[model samples]
Every structure is written in structure tokens, then in C-alpha cells.
Target: MNQLEQLKKYTKVVIDSGDIENITHYTPYDATTNPSLVLKAIQMKKYEYLLQKSINYAKKKGGLKNQIVTNATDKIIVSIGAEILKKIPGVVSSEVDSRLSFNTEKSIKKAKKLISLYEVEFGIDRSRILIKLASTWECIQAAKKLEQEGIHCNLTLLFSFAQARACAESKVFLISPFVGRISDWYSINYSSNKYRSSLDPGVQSVKKIYEYYKKHDYKTIIMGASFRNIKQVLSLSGCDCLTISPELLSILQAKNKLITKKLFIPKKIYAKPIKKLSHSEFLWLHNQDPMAVEKLSQGIRQFGTDQYLLEEIVTKNM
Candidate 1:
């Protein structure tokens, strides 16, 4: 078997793309999308019809220009997600608007609306959708409420242990700790060559979180995301899940190699139960980690910008 097949024996592989066309070839168990990916996918000619269809749906709703654009963008995202769900047997994570990230109520509202679109309009089951949210305190809280409503969540842009700890405490369905982005930060600030596979800061971050969850027996799933290379993917061979890009997925599919499990749950455990992170404690610990602070803020802004760009596309079609 190729490396992709080898890795799938342990880790649940997820396709990280809004372009559902590539999803069939990879046959990932799950699929994930964000604002940036949705924007990129909409620009492609093949997905142009989805954009046009969404614009028409928004017009029919008869809202103001800005509201119409927002409506259309959400429709487009859900349309793409619906198409992806047909290809993969597992769930598809459709993100809430990043602009709503800091507002708990609005975040919850948007997530519900997205879920409604998938269930009512697309005729998809709520079970196959994971509402993707930022790891903000507000967003995490928003997820907590949504989870009660039977809306499972996938928290993105998670960087620090604080973020991971909070998600585990909330019993979130899944948390995506970016593997490449962490390495990107350290590469710019420190020596790049010093990190590789197991030693890579990005790889280490996921390993640390995975061990913590296993040791404590937390049920929140750890899905490693944003890999820059196959090495990082191989390093996380035994992760609960790994959302990978098409570029790296194809590389793994082409190369036949043996992949050994890197992460494992210890057979024995003996430890005192640790207290959960309070909102204040979560903020303090996350703030103490400079990389987490900068990256989380950067990720939100980037997603927000891409969302604006997607809205602009909808406006042109309107």
C-alpha cells in the first residue's frame, strides 16, 4: 500500500479543501473547509455554478445588499459542503462567519443557520455536519451551547495547550491544531533546520495535546491540520484525525512507504484529576504563549478578510 493507505490504518484522514472535486480521489473519511478555502474554490470556473446558484437564492430572500451578500456567502459555503457530503461518507465541517467569532450569541446564531441550510435546504442530516468555529472564549462558549442543541463542533485555529485544554473541557467534538502554521512561526523566529518530524514544534504541539487528552481521558477528538509536508503527516500517523491538503495527499498516495505509528495511548495511567481552565485562566495561559496569541489573531483576521473577498464575489454576481 502507498503511504496514504498505510497511514489510514491508524489515523482518520480528512480532506482539507472547499473544492469538493478533489475529495473523491482522496476518499478521506471527513472533509473540512474555512473562509479562505471557500473563497479559493468559488473563484474556480468549475465551481462558478454554485456561486451563481447561491446568488439567486440570496436575491430571492430580498434583503439589503450587505445582508444579501452574507446570505449568499453562507449559501455558497453550504452548497459546497452539501456537494462534499455526497462524496464522503463522514461529516463535512462548514465554518461560521469569522466576523462573528468574538460574539458568542451571533456565532451560535450563525452556526445554527448554517446547520439549518444543510438540513432543511440540502436535505442533509445534522449528524453529518460539524459546525466549525474559532477557538475564542466566546466561540468556545458558543460551541458549548450548540453542542447542547445536538450541533457538534470542530474548533479551528487552535495553537496553545490552553486552547486545547479548554476545548477538551467543553467536550467539543473535535479540535484542529495546525501543524504547519506552528512550524512556520518558529521557522521565521528561530532556526528552521533544528526541527524535523518528532522535534518539529508543530508536530510536538499535537503530540503534547494528544497525550494530555489520553492521559486525562478527555473525549474531545484531536485532528491535526495545516500540514506543510508529508513528513509532518507521517509524524502524526496515529492521531485521532488529520485534515490534509490535496497537494500533500497526492504525494502520499504516489509514494509507497511504510508508516509506523508515532502517537500511542499509554496502557497504564495514575494521576490526580486536574481542574478545568476558567475563562480568565484560559486567557492568561494563552496570552503567555506568544505564538498562540499572534497566530490566533492572525488566523481570525485572515479568515475575515477572505470572507469579505467571498462577499465581494457574491456582490458581483448579484
Candidate 2:
């Protein structure tokens, strides 16, 4: 078997993109989309029709320009996600607004709204949709509430064990611990010798979470994301899932025959209890870990800025 097939034996591969056309070629099990990806897709000549359709729908609603723009943007993202589901066999994660990260109630409300748009407006089933949320404490609380309501969530932008532990405790549906971003931070802070690919800080972080989940039998799935290269991807061979960009997915597909398994059943290895943190402990952890804090904040702001840009596109078209 090729590497892709070998990886699939142990991990469920997910396509991380907004372009449905590209995703069909790789045949990933699931797919994920965020505002930035959706915006990038709509900018392409082939997807301009998606943007135009959203604007035309907004104009028909006969509301204030801002309201029309907001509705249009939401509609476009939902539409793109719905289209992606047609090509991929598994779930499609649709993200909520990043600005709502700190407000639990608002986050839950927005998540419900997004689900409603996908199910009621676009006719996609809820079972195939995973509402994506930031891995903030407030967002975790919001996910807990949504989970109880039978709305599954994909806890995203996760950088540290603290975030992963909290999500697992809340019984989240899945957690996406970023691999490449963590690798990037370690590369800058530590010397070259300190950062081997096998011992990559990012890979270690995901391994820690995977071991913890297996030790406790937590059902929250681990999906590694944001890979910068094939090494990071190979390091996470047996994760529950890995949401890979088209660039990396292409590389994997080309070398499918060479891929080898690195991670399998965690029980064979030693496992330990995750050190639980109180609120103050969590705060201190966040403060002491400069990389986690920086990446968490940066990820939120970048996604938020992309969301605003998407809003602009919808408005201009309207």
C-alpha cells in the first residue's frame, strides 16, 4: 500500500480546504473549512459565482446593507461547506465567528445559527456537520452546552495540553491540535539540535494529548492540523485524524507508496494523568508558555481579520 493508504489504516485523513474541486482528487475522509479558506476560495475566478450568488440572495432579503452583507457572508460559507460535503465521505467542519470566542452564550448562539443555516437553509444534515469553535475556556463551555443539545463540535486552534484537557473534559466531539504552528514556534525559540523532527515540540504536544486521551479512554477525537511539511504529517501517522492543506495532501498523494506508520495503540506505551489546572493555574500556564499564548491569540486575530475581509467582499458585491 502507498503511504496515504497506510496512514488511513491508522488515521482518518481530512482535507482542509474550501475548494471542493481540489478535494475530490485526494478523496479525504472528511473536510474542514474556515472563514479564511472560504474567502480565499471565493476570490478565485471559478468561485466568483459563489460570492455573486450570496450577494444576490442578500439583495433579495431587502434589509440594511450591513445586515445584507452579514447574511450574505454566512450564506456563502455555508454554501461552500455544503458543496464540499458532496465530495468527501465524512464530516465537514464549519467555523463560527472568531470575535465570539470569549462569550460563551454568544458562541453557542452563533453555533446554533450556523447549524440551522446548514441544515434548514442549505439542506445538509446535522450529523455530517461539526461546528468549529476556538479552544478558549469560554468556547469550551459553549461546546459543552452545544454537545448536550446534540450539536457536535470541533474544538480548533488548540495549542497546549491545557486546552486539550479542557476539551476532553467537556466531551467535545473532536480537538484539532495544530502541528506546524507549534513547530514554527519551537524553531524560533530553541536551537536546531533541540528540535528533531521526531522530537519536534509540535509533534510532542499532539503525542501528549493522544496519550492522555487513550489513558483515560476519552472519546474526544484528536485531529492534528496546520502541517508545514511532510515530516510533521508523518510524525502524526496514527492520530484519529489529520486535517491537511491541499499542498501537503498533494505531496502525500504523490508519495503514497512511501508513507509508513509511526503511531498506533497508545496503551503499549507508558501513560500518565494530565496535571489538572485550576483557573489560576490555567492562567499561569498560559502566561508561562509564551508560544501557546502567542499562537492562540494570533490564530484568533488572523481568522477574525479574514472574516472581516469576507464581510467586505460580500458588501462590495452587494
Candidate 3:
């Protein structure tokens, strides 16, 4: 078996791309797209049709220019996700606006509206979609409410154990602990050579979260995401899932290499008391983690910028 084939034995592979066409070739179980990817896709002639179609739909619905454009942008996300769902047999993680990342009420409202849009446009069931939210406290709270209402969520940009613990407590469907971003921070602030597969900061972080969740019998899925290299992907081999880019997936497909499962699925979880943090404690802990604090904010800002760029494209088309 090729590396991709071998890797699939221990973990579910999810394609992290907005190019729906690429997803068919990789045959990933799921496909994830964010604002940046959507923005890039908007410029591609292949996905250009999706942008205009959504814009026409939004304009026909009749709203103010800003409102119409915003609606169109959201519609495009759903349209692409819907098409992805057709190609991949599993869930399509469609993200909500990053601008609403910290707004609990607005995030919840937009998530629900996105769900409605998908059902109306493609008749895709809500059960098949994972609404992606930034792992802010507000977003986690929103996820709690949405989960209760049968809207499963995939928490993104997750960095710290505090976020992981809170998401587990909230019973989030999945938490994507970023591997590459964490490694990037370590490489810049510290040293790159210090972190490798066995000792990789990103690998260690996911291992910690996975062990914690397993030890506590938490059902929240752990998906190692944002991998910078194939090493990071293979490092967390036994994770519930890994969202990989098509480029790296192709790399794995070409290599007839061995995939040694670094992570063995934990059974007979360790006995320990799980601490539930108060709101203040959660805030303080989150603030204290330098990498988490910096990366989380930076990620939100970057996504927001990409979302703004996508809005521009939508507005001009409208």
C-alpha cells in the first residue's frame, strides 16, 4: 500500500481544500474549507461559476447591498460545501464567518442560518455537516447550544489544552488541534530542529489532548489539523481524523513508504479527576499560554481578512 493507503488504516483522512475537484482525486473521507481557501477558489475559473450562481441567488432574494453581499458570500460557502459533499462520502466542514468568531449570539444565529441554507439549496441533511467555529470561549458556548439542538460542530484554530478541555466539556463533535501553526510558532520563537516527529511540539500537543480525552472517556473527536509536512500528518497516526491538504496527500500517495502508527488508540483510560474551570479561570489560563494566545488571535485575524476579501468578490459580482 502507498503511504496514504497505509495511513488510512489508523486514521480517517479529511481533505483540507476548497478546490472541490481535487477532493475527488484524493478520496478523502471529509473535506474542509475556510475563508482563505474560499477566497482563492473564487478567483479560479473552475469554481467561478459557484460565486456567480450564489450571487444571483442572494440578489434575487432582495436585500440591501451589504446584506445581499454577505448573504451571497455565505451562500457560496454552502454551495461549494454542498458540491464537496457530493464527491466525498463523509461530512463537509463548512465554516461560519470569522468576523463572528467571538460573538456567541451572532455565531449561533449564522450557524443556524447556514444550516438552513444548505438544506434549502441542496437538500443536504444537517447531520452530514459540521459547522466550523473558532475555538473562542464564546464560540465554544455557542457550540454547546448548537450541539444540544442537534447541530454538530468542528471547533477550529484550537491551540491550548484549556480550549480542548472546554470543548470536550461542551461535548463538541470534533476539535482540530493545529499541528503546523504550533510548529511554526515554536520554530520562530525557539528553534526548528528541537521539534521533529518524535519530539515535535505539534505532535506532543495533540498527544496530550488525545490522552486527556481518552482518559476522561470524552467522546469529542480529536482531529490533528494544519500540518506543515507529511511528518506531522503521520506523527498523529491514530487520531480520530486528520485534515490534510491535497498536495501532501499526493505526496503520501506517491511514496511506497511505511506508516508506523505512532499513536496507539488508548484503551482502559487512566483514572483521573477532570477539573471544570470557572469562566475566570478559563480566561486566565487561555491568556497565560503564549503560543495559544498569539496564534489564536493571529489565526482569527487572518481568517477575517480572507473573509473580507471574499466579501469583496461577492459585492463586485452582485
Candidate 4:
């Protein structure tokens, strides 16, 4: 079997891309998309029709250019996600607005709106749509509300155990703990000597969350995302799911026979008993961890900027 097939025996492999052309080559079970990805896709010559169609639809809706652009961007994301579902048999995650991250009610409202847009406008089912939200306190709260309404969520930008624990506690659908971003932070601040062999801090973060979820029986699926290299990808081989970029997926596919399960069956816990943090503790951890703080804020801003740019394109065209 190819490494992709072998990896599937243990972990669910998800394609982290907006372009549908590459989906067949990697054949990931599921796929994920964000504003940035949508922006990238629409910029391509082949996808120009999608962008034009979105603008036409927006113009017909008879709204302001900004509104048209925002609507168009949302349509583009949903359209891409819907098309991706045609290729991959599993779910496709479409992210919510980063601007709504801190507002629980607004986040929930936007999530439902996105779902409605996908279903009524794009004709995609709710089951196949995992509403993506940042792993913030308000976003978690929003996800909890959405879950009760039978809306699934894919929590993104997750960095710490606290975030994972909170998401699991809320019974949210899935948590995407970013491995590459974590590695980036550690590599910038700390030395490589601090990590175990093949155990970068980012990989360790996902492993910690995986072990915790399994050990404690949290059904919230752990999907490792934002991998920097094949090594980081391989380190979480048996995770519930890993959303990998096409580049790394290709690398994994190339070395078909070399893949093996590295993370499976919860091992003996060696760390001291650490109580799941209260909201206060969670805040403390957030404040204490500069990397997490900076990255979380930066991630939100970046997504927000992409969203703004997407709106701009729509506005200009309309």
C-alpha cells in the first residue's frame, strides 16, 4: 500500500487546499478551506469564472459593492468547498469570520448564516459542512451553541492543552491543533536541543492533546493542521485526522512504503497530574504564553485581512 493508504489505516488524511484540481492526485478523505485559500484560488485564471459568477450574483442581490464583495467571497468559499466535496467523500471545513472570534453570539449567528448560505444558496448539506472557528473562549462557547443546534464545528488555531480541553469539554466536533505554527514559535525562541528526537514542540502539542483526549475519552476529534514538514506530519501519524498541504501530501505519497503509525494507543502518562484549567487558569496560561498570545492575535488579524481583501475584490467588480 502507498503511504497515504497506510496512513489512512490509522489516521484520517484531509487535504488542506482550496484548489479542486489537485484533489484527485492526493485523494484525501476530506478537505479544508479558509479566506486566504479562497482568495488564492479566485486569483487564478482558471477560477476567474467562479469570481465573476459570484460578482454577478452579488450585483443581482442589489446591495452595496462591499456587501456584494463579502457575499461573493462567502459564495466563493462555499462553492469551492462544495466542489471539493464532490471529489472527497468526507467532510469539508469552511471557516467562519475571524472578526466574530470574540463574540459568542455573533460567532454562532455567523456560523448558522454560513451554513444557511451553503445549503440554501450553494445546495450543500449541513452534515458535510464543518463550520471552522478559532479556538478562542467565545468561539468555543459559540461552537457549543452551534453543536446543540446540530451544527458541526472544526476548531482552528488551537495551540494549548487548555484550548483542546475546553473544546473537548464543550463536545465540539473537531479540534485542529496546529503543528507547524507551534514549531515555528519554538524554533524562533528556543533551541532545538530542548526537543526530543522527531519531537518538535509543535508535534508535542498535538501529541499532548491527542493523549489527553484519548485518555479522558473526549470524543472531540483531534485533526493536526498547518504542518511545516513531512517530519511533523509523520510524527502525528495515528491522529484522528491531519489536514496537510498538497506539497507534504505529495511527499508522503512519494515515500509510500516508509510510513508507519507513530501515535497510537495512549501510553503511560509521565507528567504530573495537572487539573483542567478553569477559565481564570486558561486566561493565565494565555497571558503567560507569549507565543500563543502573539500567534493567536496574529492569526486572527491575518484572516481578517484576507477577508477584507476578498471584500475589496467583490466591491471593485460590483
lDDT of 2 by residue, 72-112 (tens): 88788888998898898889999999999999999998898
Between candidates 2 and 4, the TM-score winner: 2
Q: Where is the poorest 10-residue window by lDDT in model 3?
A: 264-273
Query: What lDDT is reached at residue 157 by model 2?
Result: 93
Full candidate order by lDDT, most accurate first: 1, 3, 2, 4
The weakest ten consecutive residues by lDDT in model 4 span: 268-277
Q: Is candidate 2 or candidate 3 better by TM-score?
A: 3
Best by lDDT: 1
Which structure is stronger by lDDT: 2 or 4? 2
Please report how far candidate 1 places residue 78 from its true position, in Å: 0.2
Greater-lDDT candidate between 1 and 3: 1
lDDT for each residue of candidate 1 in 177-289, tens digit (9 for 90 to 100): 99899999999898847576868999999999999899888889999999998899999999999999999999999999788999999776636678889989999999999
Candidate 2 ranges with C-alpha deviation above 4 Å: 192-194, 268-278
lDDT of 3 by residue, 1-318 (tens): 999999999999999999988988988998898888888887999888898899899889987898898889989999989989999889999899988987999999999999999888889999999999999999999999999999999999999989998999889999999989998999999974657688888889999998888877889999999999988888889899999998899999999978888776577876676778777888898898999999999999999999988988887776
Error of 4 at 132 (Å): 0.5
